[model samples]
Target: MSTSLAEHVDALYSAVERAGPDAFQAALEGIVEATQRSEPAEVSAALERLEPMLARIPLGMGPDLAQVAGAMTDFGGDPASVLATLVERAAGAMEQAARFAELHRAAGLALPDPGDFDAVGETRDRFTAAVQVRGLAGEEEAEDLLQAWYCGDSWVQPVLFMNQRRDVRRALPQRARLLNGVRATREYLGTAGWLEGLLLVLDDEPLIVLDRGFAGTGRGFRVTIGGIGDNFQLHTMLAAALIGHHLPGRAPAPAEVAAATDGPDLTPEGGIRGSWNLVDHGGKWIWNEGRPSDIPHLDGVRVVVLEPEPYQRSWNAGRAYPHMAPLLRIDEPLSPQEAAAWLSRCTTSS
Candidate 1:
């Protein structure tokens, strides 16, 4: 006698429980194959023949058979097409089952309990929001930020230091404060996880943070923002200029880093020579009084040290140089034009 639909489903579920997701998929494949082999009339006759048998079995196979039958009809009596649809659906179900199984296995292997897995979805949403900000800001600004903060030679050492000293989330918040004008305290409110905290940076400086986020890879808060200010702008501007010069199709330059660094050096007239030192790293020149000053000569002007750094070194190993040194001394206070020109030259050189 033909096996009842209810009996088949009972066996299918039993196989699923005993042999896992793979067996469940195989059972689905078997059902599809059975459907494909029988003619429509023959399949109908078999269903009718097994109706009584189906009623006798305890498992709920009635709905499954009916659904399969209905699907066959929907496919315009193409049993093969119906089988294909069934296989596709079965594959999707098997995938879900496998995922759940893996999740369960992971739960068993120490660490956190499997409490609803809602956080994964929530994290994805936050990542999407962060990405959305990047989309809203155009590419040029994004590239500028990335090159300045994330890429190039000088970024490596500072990035390592920041990573060691600060938590990723906290550092990110500070960076947001500087770049986006958002307060660090405001950005960190009720932040739960690292990913969420990183997203909070975007919440403050959406344009700046988001732009850089796009040009990066990895998961779980990979972008570093803390030391971006010192060098990122210069690198970004230079990269843009290089691209503009080299690539015909790329976007125009937004702004240049030279604007920040290149300005006239103001010193006393008749070339005041004093010893100066490289006091700070932010490209500021400072010098101290009481020292023989041999500064670089240009345009009948000599550079003097305005601020002092007693322990300093110049290119000349034996020659004593100003601790806080100046590079140029313009007659009188430097005019805006002279200052601009001098700054332009310094910027171009440095």
Candidate 2:
């Protein structure tokens, strides 16, 4: 049998540790060549092996590795396969910052002019260097830097959600409370009442509804903020939102409000639903290059189910709504006792 992809990954890391960039390049090329030679089964298995390896590699090598990953995809049947692998497997803020840049490039979106100095990248590098020198105290600075630069621009909000979920789950202090909050939110929002439920969301803070001075009737406008492939992601985000709202000193991590609000499945009926929020009820839906905020106005219900207009650019997947302003403006954290009682009441209510 041919050398397994996992074995090649082992060799690749060995090259990175024992040698340097050149050796890493050579080993990456070898993996690419192996990919080109392998059958579909082998190629699929390779992607599986390559995903977790994203964490083990040097964080600095992300851009280069993403390039090589793109090259590896060239050898595969679909280009998005490798890109999706990197995106699906990225584990941390830094790793996501690097890989998401590649994802943006692969999407064929406009790239910044090469002559322009990447002030953001330079600033991040400076922060990283300082963290190395200053040690623990510098962590706050690094976090701030990551939030300012990476969280919104380079990395998507869902990536941030996944990262936070993984981090909090690892060191989750109060598991019962977290799950209880999730179940309470889910139970309270059972079929309808998301409008009032949303009020309770973010510690009873009300979402600001902006009036654009337009109203009509047609297929409702839906803005997809993040990808939700399964119920687990849905529950994780729901849980994260509760953690941010209910728990004191454990507020949602910086840049996490987007995930907390828009990451989970917006099921007014409660089930394994997708992540599409009604941004426009009867008017033109604005699609800005920046984040999308499309909280539906539940005032009009003529037919109950509105039709959707034929939309182009459906290929834009895995987009995130990070640092969204209107959602962040609402903030009045609920007390833990209130949270517990609310959960208890919701659980015990008819």
Candidate 3:
């Protein structure tokens, strides 16, 4: 087995398989080189190697391409089935990656530079391991857990329940903020990300506001405005929250809550504006992050807004999106009926 493309493929997979505790650097470099070349046989061989671990790769970033391609091949028996599987599984990986980052930062670690994920590309191996790396999951369990993550925003429930390590799953709610973070983390908030935007349909109002990240544990537990300081705060909150979330504990003490507040938000956009919209899409609730105009058929649907939660101190840039322009004012966890009544009773213009 000379160092053909196939060898590179194997080497890349081996890197993803994690040759050593810190072999990530070498594995990443090999992956970069492997993607630059075109060797179908080697790539095929590499794909075969990944065939077994295919279920587990998305628990980290090293296997986006591989997962999709592998699904295509495996789905040869039932193409539609694999297509559906890949779509949902990809979504789960997206959210889990975010949760992983939330935990990573909570652990007092710096995020890897974007350059670290540059090796990701169109090919199988390159795609397989691009956006994530190996996390705590093994092959057999990874597929189910990862898929469950994307299936719903409350994915943390299943992930937390499935894994015995409360310490790891506890990180699912790092920052208690909206799903906004690095590429690996932020990507899950929309598109490939699970949990659609929040929607509020108001009567006599010009806009039907929507906030994509409203109340899903899929969003981190600790929220940030984009600074190490915020993560530090979240770190403290996580310690307490994780304990309460996982173990039997009371709410934050008065002293602890009072001491929790830090200085004013340093990020731009002047902090939060209002509570997010929880739109009803069919029976499922979508945290709509789109513009009111996006749902043109809905009358007077002028704009969509990302309503802030005054009770929450974490940072959320969801409002910055121009599409989420129309703001809807409502209390926390407004029920669908309440939102409709508030909208109907609206006496003033949006």
Clash counts for all predictions: 22, 2, 46
What are the per-residue Cα lDDT tens digits for candidate 3 across 194-284? 2212211122233233322333222211111111112222222323443344323234443342232332322334432222322332212
**lDDT, candidate 2, residue 101?**
36
**Candidate 1, residue 250: how far the Cα is off, in Å:** 50
In terms of TM-score, how similar is model 3 to the real structure? Answer: 0.26
Candidate 2 lDDT by residue in tens digits, 49-119: 55555545533454445545544543443332343433432323333333333333443333332223455
- Winning candidate number (lDDT): 2
Residue-by-residue lDDT tens digits, candidate 1, 1-350: 65543445455556645765556555555555565655666555434433343233222222344344433332234333233323232222223323333332343421122233344444334333443454532334322322221111121112212222223224332333222221221222111122122222211110010111112111111112221211222123223432333222232222222221231322212222212232211233422211212123334332221123244332211111111111111113344454344433332111
Q: Would you estimate the TM-scores of all the predictions? A: 0.16, 0.33, 0.26
Candidate number that wins on TM-score, 2 or 3: 2
